[model samples]
Target: MADLGVKTPDVMTRVSEFMPEIITYIQTIIDNGFAYESNGSVYFAVSEFHEHPKHCYCKLVPSGMSNAELLAEGEGVLSGAADFVSEKRKPNDFALWKKSKEGEPSWNSPWGEGRPGWHIECSVMASDVFRRLGDPEGGMDIHSGGVDLKFPHHDNEMAQAEAESGSGQWVNYFGFKMSKSLKNFITIQGALEQNSARQIRLCFLLHKYNEPMDYGDSTMTHAITTESTFNTFFQNVKAVLRDAHQDDSAKWEGAETELGNAIDATKGRCHAALCDDFDTPAVMAELQKLIGSVNKYLETKAAKQEKPVVFVVKHAATYMTEIFKAFGLIGNGPEIGFPLGGAEGGAGKEETLTPVLDAVLEFRSAIREAARSKNFGDILSLCDKFRDDDLPELGVQLEDKAGSKGVWKLADPAELKRLKEQEAAEKARKAAEKAAAAAEKARKEAEAGIPPIDFMKALKLDDGNTPKYTAFGDDGIPTHGNVGEAPGEELNKNQKKKAAKEFAGQQKKYDKFVAKK
Candidate 1:
C-alpha cells in the first residue's frame, strides 16, 4: 500500500489487539442463548438466531433458501476445504472459537485455551474501533469488503455483532463479489508495475462498484491515455495562467457572466454527482467538460490585453485544483516533468536525475534536428543505441509512441540488469551463429575455387569513406580489421580528420608497447 502511495489511514484497527474483546463477544452470545459450546469448541447458533422474533440470518445474502442450502454454498468458510465441523449441532452453525491444534498459537479464554474464529475476530475488532472512538452503541457507519463475504462471513459478523451489542444495521456494506478465478482481480503490485496510481484510481472510479468489473488491458489502457490527456490539459492551463496578467478593473463585457455561468453549472454538476453515491466518474466527466469549455473560452479571449478574462480563467484553475485535491490527485510535483521510472519506488532520489534527464533530452532534441536535415541515420541509430544499450545501464527506459514524441522513464534497476544480461546473451549467440555461417560459406567458396571476397564487402558493411585493413593467414583465410571508423558509420569531413588523429595516437602507443616488449 505504501508503494502505491496510499496514506496510513486514521482509525486503523488490528484484530490481535482485540483478542480479549473477542472472548467477551463470544461469552455474551453464548449467555444470550445465541451460541453454544460443544466438544470444547464454541459455535454460533444460526437456527436459534433465526427463530428469535427480533433476529434473522444473513441480511446481506437475502436469499429465501433454507439454512442447509446456504451452508452448502460455503458462505462463511475461508476456503472450499473448511467444511462443517463434526461438533457443530446445525450445518448453518459457525465456529466462534476453535480448540487450538498442536503447534498452533493459543490464547486462554473462558471456553478454554483456543483461538478466536475468523468471523468473530472482525466483529470484535469493529466493536473495538467504535468503542475506542466513542461510537460503540451504533458501530461504524460502513463495513466494506468483496461480495464473496455476503454469505457466511459478513452475515455471521452482523449476527454476532448485533446479538452482542443490540445494535441495528451496524454497517452498510458496499462492492460486489469479484472472482479471482474469473481473472477480474489484479494485485496493487501487479497493476503498479505498468501504471501510475492516478490511472488506477481513475480506472476504479470509471466503473460502477455494484457491478462486476474486469481489470484487464483495455480498461487500464484507457485509463493511461485519459490520465495523459488530463495531465496535458493541466499543463496547458498552468502555462496560460502563469503568463496572463491578473486585473479586476480591466473588464471584458459579458465575459464575467459567461464564465460565471459555466463555473456555477460545473460546481452544481460536481456536487450532484458526489451526492449520488459518490459517483467519481460522473464528477470527472463534469470536470472534463468544464476543462473543455475553459480551453475554448481561452482561445477567443486574449488574456494579456483582457486581464478580466485571465481573472476568470484563474477561477477555473482554482476550481479544478480544488476538485483535484478532493480526489487526492493534486500535487503532481513542482512542475510538469518527465515521468519517473519504477526503480525510484521507495527511494526519494528521482529529483537528482531531473536536470540530468533534461540535458539528455535537450541534446537529443538538437541531434534529431541535425539528423533530419543532414539525413544522418547514424544519429538516430546512436539514439536507439543509447536507449537500448547505454541508458538502460543507468536504469532509464526510452519509448517511442505513435503520434507523439518519445517519452523516457526510470526502469527498475533489477529489471534493467536482467534485461541487459538477456540482451548480451542473445547478442553473443547471434554473433557466434553469424561467424559459423560465414566460415562455412568461406569454406564452400574456397572448395569451388572461387576467390576469397573481402569480409566487410561480404557482410555489406564496407562504406566508401572508411578504409579497411586485412591480413591473410598461411591458409589464405582473412583476418579483418577496420581503421578510422566504427560500426554503422561512414565518417564525414570533420569526423575523418578526428578519426585519423585518434588512430595515429593509438598507433604510436602500440609501437612503443611492442618496442618495450
Candidate 2:
C-alpha cells in the first residue's frame, strides 16, 4: 500500500458527496435568476454580471476582434433555443448548470428532475469541503486550477458560492496553463513539443503569470542552443579545480572567486527577472550572460589554480538546481517528441530505419578492421563521412548543424541520461515560471491602462448576403459547403488543380499516419 502511493480523500473533498444541504446552494442560485434551468440543466446568466469593465480598457477584446469574434462571444448561431436567440449578450457568459437528458449522466434535482451542472458540482463541493475544514462562514484562502478554469468554471464557482454562502471571494492566485495533454492543443504546446525541456521551462518562466503567451517552437530551440553554450565554462571550472592542489593557495583562490562571481551574477539576474513576472525568457537572457563568464573562467584557469574552479562548479550546481526547480527544468539534452510509430503522434518508423542502421554497422565493422591495419587515409576518410551519414534515419536530425541531440528512445544509457536531465529541468522550470508569470500578469493588468482611444465608426457590417440556408443538414460531417465545387459556382482549372493538390497532400499525410495499422 505504501509503495502504491495511495492517499485517502480529505474531509472537505469528501463532504459534498454526502450532503444535500450543499446542493441546495446551487439550487438557490437558480431560483435567484443568477442561473437558469434548461430541460434539466442549469446555466449561469453570465451577461447579467458586470465584467471587470477595464478588461476592455486596454484593447483587451483582442486586436482585430472580428464580427466572427463578436459572433463567437454571442450565442447567436451556435445555440439551439427555440426562443431567446438574440445576440444581446456575450460568448464569455457560460452555463452554470447543464441539465442532463436521459442517459447523459444526471442527478434528480428540484427543477423538475435533472442533473446539476459542471460548475455547480464544483461550488457545492467547495462549500462542503470548506465547511468540513471549519471555514464554512468565510471562503477559502485559495482555490486553484489550470488557467483555463477562470472564464467559466472558477467564475461560476465564485458566483454560486457568493450567492449562497455570502462569500464572494474565491481563488487568490491563478497559475499558468500546463502541457500535460498538449499535442492536441494549438498554442504553446506546439512550441513546447519541439524544445528541450530546459528551454521551454526557461521561456515559460520569463513570461509574467496569467498573461497570454503566444508560444512557438522555434524560440524554444533557440533557448536550448543558448544554454548549451555555457557547458564549456563548466568544463573549464572542472579543469581549474583539478589544477589547484599543486598551486599557491592565494593564486588558486581567485579562480574560485571568478567562477563564483560569474555564477552569482547569472543567478541574481535570472532570479530578479523571474521575480517580476515569472519571465523565464528574461531570466534566460540573464543566464546566457554566464556563457561568456564560463569561457572567461576557463581561460583564467590556465593561469590559475584548481580550488577556485571547484568552488565555482559546486556553487553553480546549487544555483542551477534552484533555478531549475523554480523554472521546472533539468536537462540532459535536446530531443523533441518526434512522432514515432504511425499517424499523428502514434509511433516511429523503425521498419525502414532499423535495417539501415544494421547495414551501416556492418560497413563500420570492415572500416574498424582497416583502422586496426593502420589504413590511415582510408579509415579517417570513411570514419568522417560515416559519422555524418551513418546516424539512424529513424530519428536523425540532419538539419541540426551542431549535431543531433539523439532521439527520445528510453533504451540507450546516454539517451536515457539526456532525457532524465531535460525532462526534470522542464518540470521544475515550468512550476517556477508559472508562479512568477502569474504575479507579474496580475500587476500588469492592475496597473497598465491607457484611456479609451477613439476609433473610426465603420458602417454596420452584415452577413446577410447569403440567402437563408440550413447548413450541413442531416449530414453530421460538414460538406465543406461543396466538396468539389463552390455550391452554384463551377471550379476553374486553377481551383481544380489546387484542390486536387490539397486533397493528395492530406491523403498522403494522414494515410501513413498511424503505425503498423
Candidate 3:
C-alpha cells in the first residue's frame, strides 16, 4: 500500500477482535426465535425469519429464483468448511455458530465449546467499527463487496446486523463484484507496477461502479492515455499562466464565451451525474469534454497575449483538480512547477530519464532559443536531418511538441556505443586500405623508370598530385619517397587513381611471375 501510495483505512477492524460480539449476536438471533440450536450448533431459521414482516430473510439473491434454487444457492458454506445441512430442520437455514470438532479452535459457549460462523463475523466487525466512531446506531451508510457475496454472505451479514440492532436498512449495499477468473481483478502490487493510483482510480471512474469491468489491455491503455491528455492539458494551462501579463485583461475575442460555456456545461453534467447514484463515468466524460474545450481555447492565437483567457484556463484547471479530488484521483507528491505524475513517476520516486539525456536536451533547448529566425529555420532543418540520421545512430529520439520546444531522450546507450565502434572500425579499415594502395603506388613509381626531379619535391609531394620531381639530390639519386610502403596522406586522389590503374594492368604479369616461381 505504501509503495502504491494507497493510504491505510482509519477504522480497520479485525474479525478476531469481534469474536465475542459475534457470539452474542448469534445468541440474540436464537433468543428472538430467528435461529435455533441443533446438535450443539446454532443455525439461522430462514423460513421462520421469512414469516415475520420486517425480520424476513433478505432477498439479495437473483430474481426469479425458486425456493428450491434459493436453498441450493444459499447452501454454499464458508471456504474449507462443511455445511451442517443434515442437522438443520430446513435446507435454507444457515449456520450461525458451528460446534468445534476435535483439534479445532473453540470458545466456551452456553451450549458447548464452539466457534462463531463465517457470515456472523463481518456483521460484528462492521458494527463494532461503527460503534467505536461514536455511532450508537450500528448502521453503516454503505456496505460494498463483490456481487458474488450478495447472495448468502452479504444477505446473512445484513440479517444478523439488522436483527440484533432492531434497525431497518442497516446498510445501503453497493454490491460491486469483480472476478480474477474473468480477468477483471488486479492486485495492488500488480496494478501499481504499471500505473499510478490516480490512473487506476480514473480507470474505475470511467466505468459505472455497479457494472462489471474487464481489467484488460484496452481498458488500462485507455486510462493511461486519458491521464496523459489531462496532464498535458494542465501543463499547457500552467505555461500560459506563467507567461501571461497580469494587467493585460485582453480577451481572445470569443474564447471567453466558448470556454465559459464549456465550464458551465461541465459543472452541470458533473453535478447531475454525481447526484444520480454517483455516476462516475458520466462525470469523467464531462471532465474529458472540458479538457478538450480548454485545450482548443488555449490554441487560439489571441490566447497568447490575453490575461483573461489565462485566468479562465487557470480557473478551469483548479476546478478539474476539485473533480480529481472528488474521485480520489488527486495524486500525492511534491509539485515541481507542473503536474509531474502521469505515464511517468509523478513524484513517486520512480526512475526518470538519466541526467546525461536531460543535459543533452537542455543544451538543445539553449541552442534553439539562441538561434534567430533564419538561423532557427536552419537549425530546425538540421535538427530534423540529425533526428533522422545521426541521432538514431546514437540511439536517441527527439519529440517536437507545439511552440517549437522539443524533448530528446536516449533509447539505448549500449546500441549507440556499438554503432559508434562499428563506424570507427569502418573508418579505420578504409584508412588502412588507402595507405596500402599508396604504398603500392610508391613502389610501382620507384620501379617505373620515371625520374624524380629532386629529393625536396619528392619529400614535399602534395598527396594525390603527380609528384613533379622539381629538385634533384646529390649523386642524382632521384629522391624517391618510399621504396615499397607509404602513408595514404602522402598520396593525393589522382595519384592513388593512377597507381590503382597501373597496379591492375601489371597484375597479370605479377601473377605469372608468382606461378613461375
Candidate 4:
C-alpha cells in the first residue's frame, strides 16, 4: 500500500490499507490461544491449535513439504506475551500479525489485526473485506490462482482463518500450479493478436480441456493437415460438377434434386461423425467415399448414363456446399470444359458417321444381290465401288471365290437354301415308294396261299434280291425313231411273208415256256 509504504502483490497492499476491518480480526486471533502477541507480533500455534495432523496437506506439495514451512519446535519461542504458545508445534504455524517497528503501520487490538503475515492476509482480507462488500455469509465464490500455493500458503491460511471465523462459510480454496520453472504458461494479451487464429484454436483443440498439453509446432501441422484433407473432398465435388454437360446452343439439364439428395446424405454422415467426439478421421472417411462417387459421376454421367449433366451438378453443388461449410471449405462451380465430341466421334461425328455407315451397308447389300443373280460383271463393278469409296475407314477387304463350295460363295441365301430342300424331297420320295411296294405284296399274300398273278410276281421280286424287267413301249415305235421294215434283195414280199409265218408259229409254241412275258 503506497498510503503506508508497505507493498504486497500490487492491489493487496492498497486493499489492506483501506480495509481496516480485516486488521481488527487478525487482532482477535492473536487474543485467542490459537495465535499470540510477540513484541507486537502474532503467530498461530498450528498443532496446539487445530484438529489437523502435520502431514494432512503435505501430499499437495510437489518437492514435498519443507520443514522450513513447518513450525519448528524452537522457532516461535521469540513471540511473547501470549497465554498458550508452545515449542513443539510445527514451524509452519505462521503469523497472523507481526510487530511493526518505527515508521511501519501499526494498530491496537485484542492483539491487533495488523500487517497480515503471508498466510494471514488471505483469511482476514477475504472474510471482513468480503463482509464489507455485503457478502458477510458468502466470503468469495472461487479463489483460482496457482498450484504452487500448497502447504504453507493454503494449509496455514485454512487453519487460522477458518478457526477465527468459525463459520466455515467461505468457498473452498482451489490452487492451479503456476511456475516459470515448469513452463506451464501463457500470457492472454499475446494470444489475441495472432495472425493465425485457426492454427492457434486447432492447436488448443487437440487437447481435452481438463488435461495438460505442451504448446508446440506439431499442433500447427495437425491443423494444416486437417485443412488439406478436408479440401480434398471439395476438389472431388468440383470434379463431379465438371461432368455437368457443357452449355451449348442447346442446353442439357439434369435432376439437381437427386444429386443434391445424394450429396446431402454423405455430408450428414460426416457431420454426425464429427459431432461424436470431434472425430475428424471418421468424417474424412465419409468425404473419401463421397468424392469417389463424384469422380465416378463425372467420368460416366454423359456417355454411359442417361442423367442430365446440369441437373447432376446443381445437386452436387448443393450438398457439397452444405458439407463444405461444416468444414469451412468451398467449391468453384461447374464450367464448360468438356470437349464437344467423345472418343470414337469424328468431325461432325454423329452426323457424318451415321449416314456414311448406312450408305456403305446399302451399297454392300446391292453388290451381294448382284452376285445372287449370277451377274458376275455387276458384282465386280459394285465391289469396285465400295473399294474405291468407303473401304479405308470400313476396314474390310473382299476377295472373289465365285465357284467355291462354301456358304459365302452362294450369293442368295434363299436359293442356296432352296437347293438343300430339293435334295431332301427326292430322298423322301424314294423311301415312300419302297414302303408302298412291300405293303401291296403283304396284302395279296394274306388273301390267298396262291397269290394273285401280279402280286405273285411282286412277291417273287420282294423275296429275291433282284427283279427281272420287260420293256413296255409307249407306242409301236422303233427305239431310234426309225419305222421302216427291213428290206431283202431276192425275195418278193409274199414269199418272205410265208417263211416269216412258219418261223412265228414255231416261236409261239416255245413262248409259253419262254420268259417273253
| Segments of candidate 1 deviating more than 4 angstroms | 64-86, 209-211, 245-250, 302-308, 332-517
Per-residue alpha-carbon lDDT of candidate 3 for residues 1-517, written as tens digits (9 for 90 to 100): 6664467888777766677788887888888778899888888887777677776565576341245554455554431224476788876677788888888888888779888777888888888888887767588876778766676778788888777777767786564756657445668888776666666776787888878777876777678667767766665665666667867665656878878888988898889999898898888788888888877776665457434556677768888887776566665432311233335435433334454465558557756775844466567566666665556544565667688676554434443444345457669988999999999988865544333222224443445565533323363433333322553234445654544454444554455545655
lDDT of 1 by residue, 1-517 (tens): 7766567878777777878888888999899889998776798888888878877777877672255655655434432324445678876777888877668778888778778887888888778777778886547765667766677678888889888887756676456645676566678888776666766777776776666767787787677656655655655565555655544464656766787789889999989988887788888788788778777676656544444355666677677767766676644532332233443355555675775587578668868887778968668776777777667666666677577575665544454565456457669988999999999988754433322333322322247655353443354333343543554344455644544454444445555655655
Give Cα-based local distance difference scores for all models: 0.67, 0.49, 0.66, 0.48
Q: Model 4: what TM-score? A: 0.34
TM-score of each: 0.64, 0.50, 0.64, 0.34
lDDT of 2 by residue, 103-220 (tens): 7655555755444545566777766667777886436764545654444445556666665655445445555554335543554444434543445555555555565554554445
Query: Comparing 1 and 3 by lDDT, which wins?
Result: 1
**Model 3 CA lDDT for position 210:** 77
**Position 338, candidate 3: lDDT:** 23
Error of 3 at 224 (Å): 1.5
State the lDDT at 484 in candidate 1.
37
RMSD of 2: 19.0
CA deviation > 4 Å runs, candidate 4? 1-14, 28-33, 52-66, 69-90, 102-114, 125-142, 167-178, 182-517
